[model samples]
Target: MNMTPAPKAVVVGAGPVGCLSAIALAKLGWDVVVYERRPDIRADSLQASSCEIPARIPRPRSINLTLSARGIAAVQSIDSTLVERLLYNAVPLQGRMVHHLKGNPTPQQYDRQGHCLYSIERGLVNLIILETAAAVKNISIKFSHKAVGVDFKNNVLRLCNSVTGQEFDENFDLCIGADGSNSIIRHFLMRATQMEYSQHYLSHEYVEIRLQAGKNSSGDTFLLDSDHLHVWPRGNFTVVAMPNKDKTFTCALFAPREMFDNLQYPDALIPFFQAHFPDLLSLLGEKRLLSAFQNNPRSQLITVKANLYHKGSVLVIGDGAHSFVPFFGQGLNCALEDVRILSALLCEEKGGCDPSAIHRVFKHYSESRHEDLIAIGDLAMDSHLKMRRSVATWSYTIRAYIDNLLYALSESLFVVKLSQTIFGPESTGWIPLYSMVSFRPDISYSAAKKKAEHQKRLVDSVGISLAILGLGYILHAFINLNKLL
Candidate 1:
């Protein structure tokens, strides 16, 4: 009789990507273990909320993210039940409603047919993922297991438990690090192999504010457009809101580090909000603003680029490989995709027990994942300018209109494709490669962008035709009016 071997894989970090990574690997028949330095996020919820905790708490102005096709698909790929649960609690953002500094309202739908992104609480989402992981029978999740160092030469992970401060070492058949931006795993891998890395800190700082959803004259729950991501674009800074499952919204203010420093005390804070984020004051309240402003820590944004993602027996994914600015809201989405792709690749290479084989897989992951990571990172940074300034400009509105018109002309096939990729029952291959990459199961990020470009051209052709037709109609109407005059 022939019996299958129990393959073992270990993951660092119990964050969303890390949990999802363990889940995906477990589903592939690997005995998975996830090590997190902190306690169960739910158990540590209040304890985690220190004003000085830069590593744990959210930065005020940073966006939580709009989990679109790619992100949802990745999560669903691991467990459909988990996907349903996520959607049940999520706040759907059907479009971006850009509020100009001048107070003009314009909306842009993410999908051609008006499909939207979902707004979820980062902390809550992390909790759900972590809890789901804990329930997996084949997976072992050890909280408070901080990875202090890694030794690739002997395939060893050195960790210190937060509660005990006792040091220990664990060996895995294969280890993956989803340990995030300041990953110790990546640092260790660099020493064993030739790895190039660059870290850049942006000039921006962000602060979080809250908005209430009170009954208006009609007694509706939402104060702003509930199905849209609302933004107040102020040059060099911005205020954006994402709705919660509850009637409230989470608003964040992103500004320059210098500007944030100027807001030293609670008194200066109120007047500043009144001048810049005037609409938010009534909801945030003078007292809450004063307290939150005085209490909350300023969050600094940074981007890290790791050239080689792994060495020897270990591999790294998510923010450990590339950390980006939050403007595009793709940070989480992209991280989730990393797990999907890496899992599929490892499966393709067959269940691994060999260290050299694992090293080769990491090489492929780094090389293949690079283009998509770089492209998205660049797009995210570029979006900061758009979110803070251009969202209010005439050019921005016109460009959006053109983009939408093109999307509409495509018969919204890509939109349908996106929905299918994100919400459909089929596996990754059924969708367009872009849909697969962005929302499907296994396509790479670079391939997704390539497919998106093809679809964009088709949409653009239709838009140009509509523009020309509209112009022709105007010309004819002018000639007829002149003759009548």
Candidate 2:
């Protein structure tokens, strides 16, 4: 009896998501080929001088990533060792430190139990995943190979070699597109199928800045509290800083394009920073701030939403399928989760490496993951407003307080028994929306969204009821005082 050969999977774009997908496929005994448009970042880092600062510093183009539970869970699912390696150099951000112009900064913890986000340099994490893929025996990584087009009917991907300037085609049993927001595979899928797609660019753009590592009055290496993500929310725009393992911070200034364009000349940045981010100016020196303003590239924020991630043998994941703004810091987390979900679905198939079962797996993945992708994308976009403005408001604070309070109370012995008796054994219990979305991998994104919406309505109703009762009490007191008079 003859056995069928192992299935082959061609992955475009060797970013974090693509590399994770390749690793997943390789672990399942499939031959995986990953094509990256740029040179291997690991090789570049190795060749650079030891004294040279990583691309993350001095230059104002780095985007720091916040790795939360979703991303951590997904990576752990692949291999817990991978999670350990990726987070070895990461800084733990316990909460957001909201900076104020007139007062001292206030810290807002993400969870009641002190669970926090891991702040890692984006490029570093990508390099780690790519290197991990390179070590897998069944996975082959081809660098400087740009994917230009695809032939869905023939199951062939067209690529151009950046080094040799030669065009070639590779056929595969499966093609996964993790090429990011401007994915070439996604473009092909749009033409091949009736896939609905939409993209929205936020008016706000961002520029990166670095806060140098130095000792404070306390003699600590970190200038700011390394345990928290620092934010200066100015309503229309916000400046955020994340700590690095080296004690320095990668700060990003997110503002309207008009605001950035107005400060085209370096001199204009002084007044702008003085007015909006007065406290930040002393930290990011006037000279460095002005230089970054004049020289750094301003990148646009965009959200991409697409339906039917898979068509025929081709499938799109990560930013290729859905891209979100960075406000919620869920873009990378959601992308990694995509890999975890897809891998599980594929593994459950009876014929693991059979080409015939590929479509079934793809279809199931597309159907199962679409809603969650859209939910997280919308949540990320909405979070920009909340982070920059609502976070400073009393209403937002009270609601969050109530949400957290309910979650804490729900865990108490008395409340748990009472809730169980009142709502019965089927009760899901109380969980804050942020906790559900960030900490609980068991809760699906769509389910979390629904639960949050329901919780919001309940909170609103109770608030209104209390306000009315307070008003009635005041009126009754005034009437009684008048009668006594």
| Model 1 spans with C-alpha error above 4 angstroms | 1-5, 43-63, 215-220, 353-356, 411-444, 447-485
lDDT of candidate 2 over 177-279, digit per residue (tens): 9998999899999998999999999999999888888876866488789999899888999999999887889999988999888888756878888988987
Root-mean-square deviation of candidate 2:
4.8
lDDT of each: 0.74, 0.83
Clashing pairs in 2: none
Runs of candidate 2 with Cα error greater than 4 angstroms are 1-3, 44-60, 216-220, 412-427
lDDT for model 1: 0.74
For 1-485, candidate 1 gives per-residue lDDT tens digits of 99976778889988889999888888878898899887665544322222111123332244565687778767766777777767766888877888764556778666544445788778766766777787789999899888888777777788898898899998787899888899988888777778888999999888777776788676649778788888888898888888877677888788898888888776687788888777677777898777766766778889998777877668888999999887777888889878767766777667454665677777787787788788778767877888888877887667666555543454323333321332223232122322344333344555555665665576579778999999999999999999999
Each candidate's TM vs. the true structure? 0.82, 0.92
lDDT of 1 at 62: 42
